[model samples]
Target: MSETITSDEGTLIQESRVWQAKGWTARVIKNEEDDGWAVAMYKDGEAEAALIGPWTMGRDKKNPKPLDHNAFNTLVKTASEFVRRHEQQLHASLNKSLMLNADDTDYKICLQIIPDEDDPHAYLSAFNNNGEQIAKIKVRPDFKLNPSSAAKWLEQGFQRLD
Candidate 1:
């Protein structure tokens, strides 16, 4: 049985092979692909582990190293950074922005994607230097959001995109 401890820091489980604290859980498991060990790091409330990597073998060379405060902290830091970078990449891919000068007025054009499984789409929007929205229209999710497309849209006076 696994022992659970609650304290000022947070809920913690410091078993030999399992450690949970700081909104993360680290589990040591046998690597199916080889006769070695692996560690899985899961963020709290998430069903799937965020990271899985090779684990160091114990002195006996047949078992995994026991989880400890230092090892668990390092795993939490690595997993948290992994999840953060993934989120940033996803956000960058789904949302984009550019600046252009039209009629001597600076304009900011942005594209935000809505990935609905049934009806995928995106919103193309423009704002003036004053931060006031100038135009917005729904466009296909696959709509290209690049300098050429943005210039074309600006040349057309931000008309509804087909």
Candidate 2:
């Protein structure tokens, strides 16, 4: 029978091979590719696992290391960083921005990608100095948003095209 214990953030199940804490869950399972073990980390309420990698065996070499306080804390830190970096990368890919130094007006131009299975889209928007959106236009999915590119687009009356 698996033992369940209440942790500060979540629960720990020895038999089921799960350590849930700090809005994340670290689960150890048998590696399908070989006769080894792997650990999967999932964010709270997320269906997909965020990270999965090999797990170290205990001293006996036949079982995974127990999820003790130290191990659990370390796992939480590693898993948290992994999730953080993944989020940063996702944000960078989906959204981009650049500053405009036009002679009469300054603006911040942004391009945000809206991903959809059937119809992917993007938006090119410009915000004035007061953080007010002055112009927003729906653009193609693969619009390049960078300093030089944004400047050129703005120079051409905010019309972006290849």
| Model 2: lDDT of residue 36 | 84
Report the lDDT tens digits of candidate 2 across residue range 17-84.
77665677778888999878998878888998877889888788988876655665787788789878
Report backbone clashes per prediction: 0, 0
- What are the per-residue Cα lDDT tens digits for candidate 1 across 5-84? 99776778889899998888899999999999999999988999999999999999998889888999999999999999
C-alpha RMSD values across all candidates: 1.9, 3.1
Using lDDT as the measure, the top candidate is 1
Flag regions of model 1 displaced more than 4 Å: 1-3, 8-11
Poorest 10 consecutive residues of model 2 by lDDT? Answer: 9-18
